[model samples]
Target: MTAGLPEPAGFPDCPVCAYVLTGTARLCSDCAGRTLQPVVDPHCPVCSQAVAPGGQCGNRLCTLPLQQRGFSRVDAVAVYSGALKDKIHKLKYEGRRGWAMIFGRLLVGWMESHPERMRGVDYVVGNPTHPTRQPIQHIEAIMDAAYTEDVTHVLPLSPPGAHRLVKTTETPRSANKNLDDKRTAAAEHAAALTWTGDTSDIRDATILLVDDVLTSGSQLQHVARRLRASGAADVRGLVLARVPWSG
Candidate 1:
C-alpha cells in the first residue's frame, strides 16, 4: 500500500521487524501476531485502564495527577508491556525510526475503531522533541504516517528546526520514580517549555495530543497546559501506550 507522503511508490519492508515484505503488508506476520495489544473493554472511560469487576475505575479518585492536567480525557492503544514495550524501546533508543510506520498504522486503526475520539478534534499533534535530543523526532514520524493523507487531523510535522513547543531544559527521567519525584520533574519540564507559533489557530480549538507512551504523564501535562493557555478550548490525549496502574 501507499506509504506516507509524498506517497512512496511502495513499502517493501515490515516496519516493526524490518522483515522483507512480499505484498502490501505493512508489518510481518510474526510481529503483527505478537504486538499491538489494544486496550479493551471494562475499562475506565476517563483513563482507559481495565476496571476490576465490581471495583471502581481505579482512576475514579479525584486526587490522581492526570485528572488535574489540562486534558479532559485520554485514549491509549495498548498497555506498555511485553513485545510492544520492547519495540518502543528500540524505536526511541536504537534509531529504528521505521517502526514509526507501524505505530502510525496502529494509531490510525485505533482512531477508526473509536470514531468518537476524533469528534471535534481540530488538529493532531505529536509531542515535540528537542532538536539536540536526537537525530530524528520519532513522534513526528509516527504522526506523519498516521495522518499524512488525512489533512483534517494532520499538521505539518514539526522538524527539529521549527517546533511549536520547545523543551528549554532537560529534566530528570521519570521512569520508576516516586510520585513526588515525578511531580518535580513535571514542574521542571513545564517551567522550561516555550511556545513558538501563532496562537490564532489554537484559539477556541480542540486539540488531540499524541504521544508514544504515558508514564508519569509529566510530558503531556505540561504540553496540554501550554496548549490550553494558548486558547485551546479542550485538549485531549491519544497515546500509544499506558503503564498499567501498579497500585
Candidate 2:
C-alpha cells in the first residue's frame, strides 16, 4: 500500500531545485538567483549591448543617429543569457506566463538603479502582439514591469483592448533574418496602430515603451514611428534583454 499524500504546502519541492522549499517563499531565492544575470557591463545607449567600461556606442546597426530611429533611447534589464533566455523561450512557446512577474520585477529594479532613464516619462506602453497570437507574454511583461515599478500611467495596447498599435500580419522570426532583411521585412508588413478613439490628451505626452527582448530592434523602430506620427512628444524603449546579433 502507498503512504498518504503530503499536507497542503508541506515539503513543496522547488521547481528549479529538487530540494524542499521549507520557507514562506515558493521558489527559494538561492535557486532563483541562479537564473538571474545582472547586466554588470556598461551598455550602449542606443542598442543596450554591453560594451567596454570606456566604450563608445559603436554598434552601427543600433547606434544610428537618434534622429533616424523610432525611439530616442533603449535600455535592457539583463543580458539574454542563462536563466533569462530559457524563461523567455518558455514564456513565449510554453505559456509560462508566471515568468512575467520575475522579468517585470527585474526591469523595475533596473529602472530604479538608473533613475535618469525614467525622468519625465508619462505613460508606459507595451509592444502589442498580433490578435492571432492569443497569450501575449511580452505584452504582460511590459505591464508587469510598469506595475512593479509603481508606474501608474500606462497604455493598454494588447489584445482584447480596443485601441492598438502595429497589428503584425505575420509573426516575423527576427533572429532568422539578416539586418537588411529585418529592416525590409519590418517596413513591408507595416500598418501603424491607428487610434479612432480620442488620443488628443496624450498628444504632447512622453511615453516609455517596453518589450521583452531587442533582437533586430526592427519592431521597436516600427512602433516608435507610429507613436511619433500619432503626436507623441517623445517615445523611449525598454526591454528585458538585448539579443546580440548572431549573424
Candidate 3:
C-alpha cells in the first residue's frame, strides 16, 4: 500500500512525490520546480528546436525558411529529462491516465504564464496516434484534460476533439532512425496523416497544435501542413517537453 493512499477529500496526491495536494494542484510546486528543466536558450523561434549557441536550427531536414514552415512558432514547457521523463514514461507505458489531467492542468498554467505563445489561437488540436498501434492515445488525452481544466478561460483555445488529426498508418520508430532516415520517415508519416474534423470554421482560424514531447518535430510539422492545407491562417505548437540540443 502506498503512503498517500486513501487521499483526503478525493484530491489526488502528487504523482511525483505522493505529497498531499492543496487547492487544485497536481504535482507539487517543489516537484514541478525540481523536475521541469527550462528549454535551453538560442533555440529556433519557429520550431523551438534547440540550437548551438552560434549555430543554426538543429533540424537539418528543415529546408524551408522560418516563415514558410508549417507552424508559425513553437514553444515547449521544459526539457525532457530527469523525473519529468519518468512521469511521462509512466503515463505512456503504465496506464497512468490520471497523469494526463495533471499534465493538462500544468499546460494550462504554462499557457497562462506565457501569453504570447498562445496569443490568437482558435483551436487546440492534439497530435493523434493510430488506434490499432496503441491502446490509448496519449496526446489526445492530454488535450482533453487541458480542456477540462482551463477554468479561467485565459487562452481563447478549445480542444476540437481527440484524434482530430488522425495517423492513418503506422510508421517506423523515430529513435531507430538516423537524421536522413528520420526525415524520410517523417515525410512518410506526414503523408499518412489526415484530419477528421470539420474544416469550415478553421478555414482561417489560428490553431495551436499540442503534443506530449517534441522529438524530431516532424509530426507537428506534418500536422501543421495538413492544417495549413485545410486553410488555417496560422498554426502554432505547444509541447510539454523538448529533447535538449546535443550540439
Candidate 4:
C-alpha cells in the first residue's frame, strides 16, 4: 500500500470525529452517514430556507419578511448540527486546519450534485476575516476544492495572498444567546467589514461566497450587497452548515 494512499476499500478519516483508520480514509462509515438537514421543508427557492407553510419566514429569530430575501441563490452543505457541527467547531476554534479542505470538498460535492446551477459562476470567495487572525482556514479549503480533479464543480484558485475582504469589527459578537438576538448581532458585526479588491473581474460575474456556517447570513448579505454595489451580476452562498433557529 502507498504511504498516504487509502488501502484498497479503505475510507478516509472522518473530518468531524477522529475515527481511527489504518490508511488514507476520507470518511468512515459513521461520519459518511452525516447529511444536510432541511430546516425549511417548503423553503423559499431563492434563500433555500424552510419558510412558514404559507410562504412567509415564520422563524421568529429572523424578522426579515416571511418572503424570500438575500443572495439571489443560496444553498448549504449540511444542517448545522450533529457531526457536521462538531467538525465545524474544530475547524474554527480548534487548530484543525485540514478541516477547511474537508468542508471545501463537501461544498464541491454538493455543487456537483446540482450541476445545472454551476453555470455562470465566475468567482468563489469566503467571508472576510479580521486581519488579527493568523490564517484563514475555509479559504484554504475553497482553494483545495477548486483543484480537486474528480469534483464536478471543479473551480480554480483566485489570486494568492489577495485577501481583499477584511473584517473591521474590534469586538466579537454574541448572537449565541437566541435567534432574534443573533439576527441583530450578526447584522451589526457583518457591517463592520469592507471589500478591498479589483472590481474589474467581479462586474457582471456570478460570485460563489463560501463560509463555514450560516447563522444569520449577515456576513454574506453584507458582502453580497457590497458586491452588487461593485457591479457583480449575482451572488450565491456555499456554506458548510446552516443553524436551525426558531421563534
Best by lDDT: 3
- lDDT of each candidate versus the true structure: 0.65, 0.60, 0.69, 0.58
Give RMSD to native, each candidate.
Answer: 5.7, 7.2, 5.1, 5.6
What's the candidate order when arranged by decreasing TM-score?
A: 3, 1, 2, 4
Candidate 3: minimum summed lDDT over ten consecutive residues — where? 21-30
Cα RMSD for candidate 3? 5.1
Off by over 4 Å in 2: 1-35, 53-55, 61-63, 134-137, 141-172, 188-192, 195-197, 245-247
TM-scores for candidates 1 onward, in order: 0.75, 0.71, 0.79, 0.70
TM-score of 1: 0.75
Highest-scoring model, TM-score: 3
Report how far off residue 129 is in candidate 3 (Å). Answer: 1.0
Which tens-of-lDDT digit does each residue in 1-113 have in candidate 4?
33474433321244333333221123332234244454457775655566667767543324544222346756776568776787677766665766655555566555655
- Please list the residue runs of candidate 3 whose C-alpha ends up more than 4 Å from where it truly belongs after superposition: 1-13, 16-31, 50-55, 61-63, 66-68, 154-163, 168-173
Model 1 stretches astray by more than 4 angstroms = 1-35, 60-67, 149-163
**What ranking emerges by lDDT with the best candidate at the front?**
3, 1, 2, 4
lDDT of 1 by residue, 20-79 (tens): 322222233223434456676787766677777665765532235543567777888788
Give the per-residue lDDT digits (tens) of candidate 3, residues 1-247: 2245543222124543434323233333223544468777787876677777887885743667544568777788778887677778878767688788778777876776666777777777777666665546777777777777776655554553644567888877566768778767766777887767686877999888888888767767767777788889998888888877575
Model 3 TM-score, all chains together: 0.79
lDDT of 2: 0.60
Mark the 10 consecutive residues where model 1 has the least summed lDDT. Answer: 21-30
Write the number of the candidate with greater TM-score, choosing between 2 and 3: 3
